[model samples]
Target chain A: MSWEIIKQSLPMFQQGFLLTLYLSLIGIIGSIIVGIICSLVEYFKIPVLNKILKVYIEISRNTPLLIQLFFLYYAFPAMGIKMSAQLCGIIGLIFLGGSYMSAGFSGGFNGVNKKQVESGKAIGLSRWQLARYVIFPQGFALSIPALAANIIFLIKETSIFTVIAIPELTNTALDLIGLYYNSNEYLFVLVVAYAIILIPLSIILTLLERRVRYGTFGN
Target chain B: MAHSGINVLFEGTNLTRLLLGMWTTFKIAAVAIIIGLIIGIILGILRTFHNPILRFVLRIYLEFFRIVPTVVLLFLFYYILPRQMNLHMPGTQVAMLVFSLWVAAEMSDIVRGALISVPIHQKESGLAIGLNKFQLYRYVLVPQAVQLELPATINLITRVIKTTSLLMLISVMDVVNIGQQIVEANNQKYPTGVFWIYGLIFLLYFLIDYPLSWWAGRLEKKRLEQTNGE
Candidate 1:
């Protein structure tokens, strides 16, 4: 709990913060790609894959992120593929985040008027063109708020990566706690790190969403 | 490239460990759900109470739980809370307390939202029928509110069960912890089964979650059908 311990550990803590940022950045990109692809398949009305993807989305979204991480980090090694805990953690977050992203995006698509699609068809847009110009643009705009929330969720979910030995913000805090063995010394500071990582990001997301929703495109 | 270094899980020799982990997972899930449901109901009602003070308290409580990550909360409860307050409690016990408090707040919000969505006409009709406010809420409001809330309620159940995995990080030896144990023990001996162990855990979760989601879907469909029929 001493200032000396906290001061000395500053660099250690920063390294962990950097790790969290790196993992979350990669995870967010991977998840958004997976989400967009899955959403397109469902929106395009793919027959069999639609059913599988629907089931995938439901199961992944309903289960906790912790369980998903554990299954990949702890259980996968037994199944024969040797995965580092960090890789397991990252992949699990991507899958979990992607599934949630798809759910929100699908809801956005559902919110779109069916006539919008028909109008695109009438304009002689190919399926890809229709999706890019007419469908996805609109759905992405509508889904932005929810998508922002999902990114926040992804940030928090990454905290659990500590259990799998990934050197992220939470693990750094826990490691610091272990070293100090004093709750007040590092615990509250860790909470601040978490808040720091999330709050501004969320605020910026909200402002950006409002801007997009109400700026020129909205008109 | 030949994969090596994980032996204990896939060799099929540690069936007992997997079963043990599975049993522990179920046990924690069962207790967590019961705790979650009762508290969730009370908190739900608390958020809607007439007292502004109570409502404010509930709002703060909800916001705190909503934004804070569960793992951080778990670490606080398991590692910090007791020490700061001078209590000596076990990890699993603290986990229950922390999760119950958190889940209650979430469930309460869901319940309140569902209750508010009930048509105003239903309340007016109840008053016209000469039912007291308490009796009206109990018989008329509660039933309809619960029916509307059931799908989300089931969803929260899955969320609670899955969250028990956090206990593993804190050394509670739940299913995930047990899986990790077997993997660590056999990592040198069998080196290849880690994937299967994880795959089983993955399938186990999907297996449990699938039916609940299906049931929620059916409940939602029935609600819609009832609405359409009306």
Candidate 2:
């Protein structure tokens, strides 16, 4: 393997890294919002929506992310709507991420003290106001560890977007590696590239989770 | 391409192809679950130890496995492990290795979580009843931990099943591979074979997964009812 050639191509690969970051950032933020909403819908026990949301979460959660990507990428366009690959990938990620978020957020919701809700009601708060002011913060704090784990999972899963031909880190690495008869060099480089992205993210997640756990305990 | 051509896809052997796909999928899933459960439990306990070096080593193992995507992990074991280490195994064996490590890491986390979830009071109560520490764990702790662990364990099983699809990317002749091959073979006769072929695979996964998942939800619900009943 020519170190010089790889050294030169590093810029292109760096661009791919940016794309992966962009995709994951958008996916995480969008899905967290989606997840919180889904959790609330479940938490408040929406009458007709309760069953619909439950089934939706189940389907999204049970199947593989890859199949979901395929559905979004291949199935949707055939129905006469067009979307960019990145959009499809993001949407797919959000769908999976959102479902996961519901579980964590709801778990956190359940962790909130029952007294807190009762007190809110005692104070003559409307349901929405009680949920917004009293319930969400406590629920959010309690579910932080589980929520962080899901976000970390979302980061790891972003690599699957490579299948839909997004030039993210995994795809970029695989592209370069595929050219080489020496598969070992490529695989190592790919693994290192992954470690570079994931390890720091893992540390950040751990620290965030610990901090959240501390706050929850203090409360 | 747009709306799924699922109807055309499952026209004839839809049921058979789905069953075949699931048979293969579940075979991999079944093996992975059993092996993953064993490995996860061992490592989880290893992680709970007071030994600094051992804890550090297990932490690194857990983080490494957790960080690497299963697809990349599979590729490492399938392509590079043999070249660098001369440990040549069949694709299935290589996949088992990659997934076992993955399973081990995640399961260990679950095990750790379950163990911790058994209230500290419960263990103390056992002690108050004159039970020793190890005896307290064996008798008072493990069962409750198992109950909490069941749902998460089911989630892991579902994950392993879904992940097995990535095996096809590396030419593993899995359910996806089989579907692709048949689709390609019939491509000349029907231009839309890819749709039906893959769609069939999708249904197969749903068929296999939905029921087990329903059971898991039921377990969680039963837990709730029991707690409510109490």
Candidate 3:
């Protein structure tokens, strides 16, 4: 409501925004890598790893990221494993994001046409060759929309890093409100800052989805 | 040290307190889902109609909830609403309000998708059979849609339950919050208790959510089998 509070808080919000961006970017990339490996393991029917991944996915998906962060930040230290808040935040994001992403990717992998795999096999392509030439591209393309949704979900999730004292955007806003009692202004700035980051990112992802769809299907 | 961590859980009323906190979480989620389901059904039915303005408004509502993080929304409602609107609600109520609105937005989409997926011939057949619009939906459309909607609705319920964990941020003392309190209280005496406390919270959530998810998957599979058989 007041420009004065908004003006004074912009710098802090900017710093918080950068941290959020950095955390989300790393989280997004880390999860995607984890997702790819996990999905591939499932796709190939790896024995021991497949069972472990299943349990991992179920546990990760069912629990909230906040609880996971709490366990990492608070509990791990007691168990003689020390991690900074930022590291805990990143690990939490990947831990949560990986399961969802793997679900999406595996859906794509399973949805790959049966006839295509057969044809690749008939053409004398090796297993690795078939996966490289036949499965991965189509599955990746098919997974794009789900991947985009997960990316946005991960970004929004970064808001909770405040609980671990990471000083992200939500934390900055909370801190400002605590110090100044100017809830309206700080919340307004917080919302606008998120809009600034998320709106454009969503638009870009949507565009990327469209581009991939058209590129792959020629529709 | 290993045994001490496990011992902390059974010490005093720590275990009971955690279960009570879990109950509070379930209560909030249950109330929110019920309220959200009622409103969402109406909004979803409205969305099926050819009303441009209503559709646009509903889209905005859905997008608003989709874009904003749940934590931020909780903070907005819990902190700002009392100051701006002079409404002093408890944190539990505020959490319920925000979550209900969120669930409603999500549920409406699920409902809309299920409703729209019902073939057009079913509605036309109902009209030709002397059924009025209300009866058409009640007898012909909704029953069919219910089968399609149930699995997704169950999934949404699980989502709502998981999200209720965020209520701790507003100081609603859900299971996670209680776990944190227990850990802090026992820090010196049972310094390794943190692992056990949080691990139990994690397992508790898994126990509650996994069954629902499994049920939803079974229903979805059954639906698929029925459709494929037809």
Candidate 4:
């Protein structure tokens, strides 16, 4: 409500915002790489690694990121595996996000038609060639919507990094409220800041989804 | 380092306290989901109406909840509402309130999708059979939609249950908070206890959530089979 407080707090919020953006970017990229590897293992029906990845995916998907972060940040120190809060936050996000992304990617992999694979084989495409020319592109196209949803979910989840003392936007707003007691102004800024970040990202993803849906890659 | 980390869980009433905390988590999630389901059904039915203003308003509500993180909303209700509106509700109640609104927003969309997915011929057949509006929905539309909505509803229930972990942020003394308290109390005596305490919390959540997810998957598979058979 007050412009004066808003101006005063802008720098702190900017710093928090950048941290959040940085962490989310790292989390998204890390999870995508993880997802691709896991999906590939599943698609190829790799023996021991497939079973291990399955259990990892199940445990990761079933647990909340908050508790996972608690385990990493607080519990690990006791086990002589200390990590910085930022490190914990980054690891926790990828640990959680990777499972969800792998599920999405595998769903896409399953959706790639058997006929397509057969035709690729019929055309003398080797195993790697079959996957490269036949499966990955179509599967990636099919997975676009799921990937977008997981991205949004991961971004929103970064709010909880505040619990481990990361100075993300949520943490910054709480700090300002604790200090100034201007809960209205700070909360307003928090919501608007989130909206500003999330709304455009969602719109862009939707556009991306549309392009994938109608584009020639899948068809 | 001298003692095992597992000792902390069995020592004193730590285990009992953690179980009680899990109950509180369930209590909050149960109340929120019930309230959300009732309101969401109403809103969803309204959304199926041809009113432009109502549709627009509902869309805004859905998008707002979807875009904003649950933690931010928790802060708004728990921190801001008391000072701004002179409301002095407890943190648990505020958590329930925020989660209820969120679940309602999500459920309404699910309901709307299910309702519209019912073929137009069914509604027309009900009308031709002299069924009034209420009777039409009760006899013809809702039953069909309910079947379609069941798997999605189960998935939502699992989501709400898992999300209750956030209640600890508001200092509601849920399972996670209680675990933290146990770890703090036993830090000297059981230096490795933090791992066991949080690992138990993680397993507890997995036990509660995995069954529901499995059931939802089963329902989804059954529905798929039925549709493919038809």
lDDT value, candidate 4, whole model = 0.91
User: In model 2, which runs have C-alpha deviations exceeding 4 angstroms?
Assistant: A1-9, A46-50, A76-82, B1-18, B121-137, B188-193, B221-230
B75-137 in candidate 4: lDDT tens per residue?
Answer: 889987887788999989998899999999999989999999999999999999999989988
Shift of residue A90 alpha carbon in model 1, Å: 2.9
Docking class of 4: medium
Candidate 3 lDDT tens digits, A100-184: 8998899777657677889999999999999899999888888888899899999999998999999999999999999999999
Model 3 steric clash pairs = none
lDDT of each: 0.78, 0.79, 0.90, 0.91
iRMS of every model, one decimal? 2.7, 2.2, 0.9, 0.8
What would the per-residue lDDT of candidate 2 be over residues B1-230, giving only the tens digit for each residue? 44334444555674576567667667766777788889888777667668999889888888888888887888777777777788889887777778877898899988878888788899789999999767876798777888888987887887888888787776665777777666555555555556666666776677667887788878988887677566
- Tell me how far the alpha carbon of residue B194 in candidate 4 is from the true structure, in angstroms, after superposition: 0.7
- lDDT of candidate 3 at residue B14, scale 0 to 100: 99
Scored against the true structure, residue B92 in model 1 reaches a CA lDDT of 72
The TM-score of predicted model 4 comes to 0.93
Candidate 4: misplaced stretches above 4 Å?
A: A112-131, A208-219, B225-230
- List the lowest-lDDT window of 10 residues for candidate 3 chain A: A210-219
1 or 3: which has the higher TM-score? 3
Ranking by lDDT: 4, 3, 2, 1
Top model number, DockQ: 4
Model 1 C-alpha lDDT per residue in residues B22-48, reported as the tens digit of each score: 777777677767887788887786676
**Candidate DockQ scores, in order:** 0.46, 0.54, 0.75, 0.78
